[model samples]
Structures are given as C-alpha cells and as structure tokens.
Target: MLPLIPYALALPLLWATGPTAPDSLIIFNASRTYHYQAIFISPAGDTLSRERITMQPSGQPWVGQPKRQTACTIQYRYNPGDSLTFAARPNPQNQPGRQPQAYEWRKSTVTGVIENPQEIWMHPIRSNQYAYTEVAPFPQVRPADLHPGGSWQANRLFIMGGWGAFKGSVRPFYQVKAPATRRYGNQNLAGCWLIESVGQHSRLGNSYLDFYFHPRYGFTEMHYRFYDGTQISLVLEGLPTGNK
Candidate 1:
C-alpha cells in the first residue's frame, strides 16, 4: 500500500495545482456535470428550438493521466431523443500541453464510425451522419494558447466529393479572432479568461464558427449564427459539480 499524504502538505499542493485546462483541444470537465441551455433560431429569424440537458459523465468518468497505455474512453450521457456516447479512444496517451498535439474524438452511429482528431479548437464536430471513415484533423485553438490580441489559423482536414467518390479534402485555412478579455455586464470576466474563436471562411460563412471557452470550464458558451441569419447560442447555466 502507498503511504498517505499528510493534510498539511497536500493542501498547499492542491492550491498550487488549482484548476487547469485539459491537454485535449476540447474543454471538458471529466468529473463534473454541465447544464447547457441552447436556443436555436430559424432562417427567417424565427425561434426554432430551446433545449436544456445535463451532461453527466456516464462512463469512465476520469481520463487517466497522460502518457500511459490506457484505453481512455470519455463518455457523456447525451439525450437527443435517444441515448448517446459522445467520445471514445481505444488508445490514449498523455500529450504535452494543449498547444501542438491532440487526441481522438469519436461518434458511433448505426451507419459507421466517425472519428476526428481533437486538435485546435474547431467544431460542428462531425455529427453521426454518413459513414465518413476517413479521419480528419479538425484544427482551431488550445486553451493555454488563448490570450489578448492573439490569433491562430484554422486548417481542418475533411473528406469531400460525391457519396461514393469521397476524397480527402483540406479545407481552406482561416484565422480565429481571440479577444484579449470579454466584458460581462459592464465588467470583464473575472477568475478566468473568456476567448471566442470563429472560422473565417466556413461553409455557411457564419455556421461552424464562434467557439467560446473559459479556463475554469473549457467552453462555457458557444455562439453560432448560420448564413441564413439563424442564431443558436449555448451557455453554461450553472456551476459544474463532480467527484473532484
């Protein structure tokens, strides 16, 4: 058995560690539950849907420390009419920081396996549609890399062409604008930095853009506006609670 750490020593260490962004591009609190309120608008600027769901870590709640031979499967309980598992990785290893490396993100549907590398912070994270087997590099931003006046290029890899003629497609690179700090209710976001990133030349021009994050919560909110003037905003409705 391992020796137990004394309270005096452990307390300070815990304080020193504090809260940190996960190495993976996506900001997820593996241990906590998040409540998100989503408001969707239609093409003619009409309200479409309002959804509120609590994301609970349904399986393998904690991702083991990086660099080990572990089958890291981070699953979240999501209900979109049916039960779903949000992510999977047969093999996961510890990566440096959230800057240059990435892990895998997956979605399993009756059709086939849709896997994409979770690198830079970009999304629309290929849903469970069409058997797109080719793994693509979806690039964007890392939490540690976000700061005032800092910008990063978004270059995602994807498959293009017809249904049967699926060919590897490299989307055009675009820039993501990061705010130095976001002000809320006449004040700046305290305790953590708020960064919003958007894809400059996304397909719908506005869709698949405006990904937001907070260091403490990793993507506390996301604002998406489609080319047709439809607006959808997702915000964290409460504080995260978990085993930690």
Candidate 2:
C-alpha cells in the first residue's frame, strides 16, 4: 500500500548530553502553511521516490467525514493517496500559552471525533470503509518520563487498502538513545531526542519506526522501515511562517 500519515514519526546525531523534550511539538502557527519532504528508500538503499508535501491548517479535515472541520491538511503530490489533514488536541490541562501544554493527534469523522489517531484513520484517495477499535493509547514520552521504557503497548485497528485492517494489541517498545545533533534544511534542531521502536506486527509482519522530537518542537520526524528493507523517511523542513 502507498504510504500515509506523515506525522507517524525520529533520527540520530552525534553524542551530546541528556536531551529533554520541549514544551510542545505541535506548536506551529495555526494560520500558516509549511512544506515538508519525504524520501522513499529501497532495500538496496536507493532513492525510489521523492515528493514535496504541503501542510496547511484549516477548519476542515481531509481524510474523514466532513462534519468536523479545521484541521491541518497535508497535501501530497505523488501517488493516488489523498492528502491527510489532522488537528492537535491540547492536553487536558489546557494551560494558557502560545504553545500547547501537550497535544494528541485528532481527527473528526462522521461517526465521531477520534483522539490519538492511528495510521488507518487518515485515508488515501482509493481507501474506503475504514474502521478501527482503540484497545489502548500508545505510549508517548512525557515530561516526567524523559527516558522511555520497554514494553509499551497499545491495541488499535490499522487499515491499509490491500486486504483489510488488523485488530490487535500493538506493543511499541522504545530505545532511548544518547542525544544527537540533527538538522532540517541546514537549520540545526535543538535538544533532539532520538527514540527507536523495536518493531510492530501487522498483517504483513514486524516493522520498526524511529522518532525524533524536541522538548519544545514536538514530534519532529520519523522513519519507517519495513521487513522487506524498504525505508520511508519523513522530516520536518521548517515551521510555518505565516498564512502567506
């Protein structure tokens, strides 16, 4: 199946010191749009396909039912997969500030609003009849838990267009590695934390994900590697400047 969910994100750099997650990763300006790039890697480590995706915040969502609006729509230039738009739901505390205290991915659909969406929640152009059950919430790195632990699990539905979706528990373990210096478009990413997932089970098999985040930046980028050795990497190029 074609790749979906650009935000399902991380990376490494040289050893620095203990890295801490920033205040919020989803702290982009709501009125502006930003551009990001994705590099598709082959088993042989060759560039398979590259595309420029656009992220723009709107009152409407791109993948699910239209009743719910005002999400950040991410448009893709390649593949039949439709663009994906998602919103960030602030932490329950609802702290008063320009940056959110904490945020979970949100998608509004005809059935209802889904918090902490899974990959399947965002649909491609040809995908249909998508449904999933949230057995549990995926583990995330919190302020208190600067370092993640092993055996973090979440049960949910993952739908890809090929056969059908899978309903089961997903244990996404984390390897909190040493701090590294990373960058986007020559701009250095500050206080980056690199976390690698051991692997996840799907209808196909086990695959892994590497995530990069900054205490202040939030969910910076991610790389997904399939068992077949196909690697998909998505990175944040720059934060949106303005509505222009």
Q: Which candidate has the top score in lDDT?
A: 2
In model 1, the runs with Cα more than 4 Å from the true position are 1-29, 57-140, 159-194, 200-208
Give candidate 2 regions above 4 Å deviation.
Answer: 1-29, 59-70, 79-141, 148-151, 158-170, 242-244
Estimate TM-scores for all models. Answer: 0.48, 0.53
Report the Cα lDDT for residue 11, model 2.
14
Q: What's model 1's TM-score?
A: 0.48
- Per-residue CA lDDT of model 1 for 137-207, tens digit only, reads 22244444456655544434433332122233333323345444544333455444444444332232423
Listed per candidate, the RMSD to the true structure in angstroms reads 14.5, 14.9
Write down the lDDT of every candidate, Cα atoms only. Answer: 0.36, 0.42
